[model samples]
Target: MTSTPTTRNPPTSTASSLLSVEGLRVAFPGRRGAPAARAVDGVDLDIGRGEIVALVGESGCGKTTLARCLLGLVPPTAGRVTFDGAPLPRSARALKAYRRRAQLVLQDPSGSLNPRHTVYDVVAEGLRIHGHAGDERTAVAEALSRAGLRPPERFFLRYPHELSGGQRQRVVIAGALVLEPELLVADEPVASLDASVRGEILALLLRLRTELGLSALVVTHDLGLAWNIADRVAVMYLGRIVETGAVEQVLTAPRHPYTQALLSVLPEAPGAPVVLSGEPPDPSHVTAGCRFHVRCQILAGGEAERAGVADACRHRELEILRGGDAAQVACHWARAEQPAAGTGDAAVGRRPN
Candidate 1:
């Protein structure tokens, strides 16, 4: 059962956003007469300069795909990504330069690091590639220090196999830091470390943002992590952001049925767990209307029936609707309650399939 939830003041961010993604979509072509798989579909997001935004969702919901697109590791099938007012460059040379300004930290340090390369070599590799290796030793040492590995010289000669899990992860972070990137897209940065080490790594990330003025987009399924660090939260479901707002606002008073169901499972939440009826819909075979209606408790509990919108819930597509000053939710019932906040009357209208 969930516990009572206490309200916290909403997180505030004054910095201007540096990364903007508009209507991003990524589709993998299928084989043997199957339909294409849509990994990321019509996602819109923004990360403020010097801010930390958490991308929270279940597995296969496209959090990592969205992060990879921002890093230019995966080309989008549609939409555009802009950094600091300019679109992502298409040429290899220009893209390479862009990469140096935005680095990625993978989830598994053991798999991402080279067993053959020492800590110093791993960190200095980026510098060498970017022609900034005039003082390789000094650069590597500084990066290690910044990543919370003190007495950087002591770790310089140690290889991946010789270090602890946490230390190896630090080395991976140091490699990203060597480039002095403005944005860091970390995919589950602490998922592989020990419980004791997780806080240390998260603390290191917070410190980096504080001391270096870095912006980050952390992709994780852990809502606790979002509460612990993010200035804002974006909730993804079936390849779209169904809810987004200040971390506290979204977590404490979630508006969408999907977001509410997720929060209801938290140990400290003040109700019984909202057990979803079935697995998430397959990306290649998404439903016609509200993708979440099949598993939504609110709809099943008679919200749609009471409003005479049950038929619409099963046949009409829903769009993200704004509410109050800082929340957005995509649900027919939510839209009906706050009609003035969304678009025309058609915003909640039914579409026959």
Candidate 2:
């Protein structure tokens, strides 16, 4: 296999980043006395106010774990998360306030909603939780309307079982929005819906962001979804962020090896598919060099060059793993070559063996 790089225009930044995560790491105790498993090694992110950023990675890459850590649902082993220049709370009260400020719309809408409660009660739940009982009815109406459940009165008394898949998902969104949060953490929110409903939910989320001034941290493994909705994209590998850049830049002109391989499998056109030769390696092993070096297509000259590239690769990888950072790469030869725009030859060192 050969590595290739393409150059594409970056997204226009309309405003400043609202949420910033620096050197975030999360670890869980291993079985017995063994070392802890580092779920999120070192991740840095920046989500501009009113902008949507997607965390793209396969299962076990720590996208969900990172989300849980950011929300304070699971305490981080290290690093910090900040919102609008204010540090997140570590205590329950502060955490509750943080949760109010940043709500989550889970993937499974059917499972998330209470079957016994009507859509009205479900949307109004957050209002009551936050002590907004005085105007609960009006708030529910507005939220429901915003989520595209028009004629809110009609859907008000309808139970979860009575609503369609799309309707149920909208209610879940309305439930989260009733709190008037600044950030929305959506974990694969459209993954469980039908193809048609997926587009509807995505459009709703985008519309909500525009109408309500809400920023988002979307977590999904689908590159197509990220390409469609996210302003910027972050690719994770083995519990650490491998690459992050403007969605256009990373999607069309990915700088990291893993990012290239990911785009490879995704359809470049209607019938194209870039298939992988083997499954990803286990994340538990904790390799010494670049976490992706094992599967990377960028080859070094000899054992010494390979080892040197691996070490240099590790250093450069972490430096440019977040948006707004310089676009530096890890591989020795590839980095030195700095592939010309729109050419695979510049990145592949001669050709694949």
* Top lDDT model: 1
Candidate 2 segments whose C-alpha is farther than 4 A from its true place = 1-15, 269-274, 300-334, 339-353
**Cα-lDDT of candidate 1:** 0.81
**Residues 1-353 of candidate 1: C-alpha lDDT, one tens digit per residue:** 22222232234432356888877889988899799888887777778788788899989998999999998889999988889879988788998999899999999999999899988999999998988946889999999999988999999898899999999899999999999999999999999989889878988888898889888999998887788778788989988887777787678877778888888888888879889898899889878778788888878999877877777778887763221224566677777654524445443322221
lDDT per prediction? Answer: 0.81, 0.74
Top TM-score prediction, candidate number: 1
* Backbone clash count for every predicted candidate, in the order shown: 2, 0
Cα error of candidate 1 at position 242, Å: 0.4
Candidate 1 segments exceeding 4 Å error:
1-15, 320-325, 337-353
